[model samples]
Target: MPSYTCSTCEREFSHCASLQNHVKVHDNAVVDRALQKISEER
Candidate 1:
């Protein structure tokens, strides 16, 4: 079977839905980092 891989972390998932859900963690991390940076710049 083919695998769904996360481009950011290179993690592998067996299903597309699982890969999509996993990607949200990375997305949230990015948002968190941006917020932290903005606060630091203030």
Candidate 2:
């Protein structure tokens, strides 16, 4: 079986779909943090 690895955190997933979803979670968190910072600076 093949495995997928996350580039940002070095986490491993057994399935590609799981890895994709996990990455999206990280991406969303990043976006949320950026939005918060912009709001604070305004």
Candidate 3:
């Protein structure tokens, strides 16, 4: 079986769909941090 890996966090998943879903968590975290930074700048 092939493994899928997350580029940002280097986490591994057995299925492509699982890896894709995991990537969204990273995306959300990035957006959250951006919002926090913007709020702090004000």
Among these predictions, the greatest TM-score belongs to 3
**Residues 5-41 of candidate 2: C-alpha lDDT, one tens digit per residue:** 9999999999999999999989999999999999999
- Judging by lDDT against the true structure, name the best candidate: 1
For model 1, residues 1-42, the per-residue Cα lDDT tens digits are 989999999999999999999999999999999999999999
- Report the lDDT of model 3 for residue 16: 100
TM, every model: 0.92, 0.86, 0.95
Clashing pairs in 3: none
Total residue pair clashes for candidate 2: 0
List all candidate RMSDs to the true structure.
0.6, 0.8, 0.5
Candidate 3 global TM-score:
0.95
For residues 1-42, what per-residue lDDT tens digits would candidate 3 score against the true structure?
Answer: 999999998999999999999999999999999999999999
Query: For every model in order, what is the number of clashing pairs?
Result: 0, 0, 0
The candidate with the higher TM-score, 2 or 3, is 3
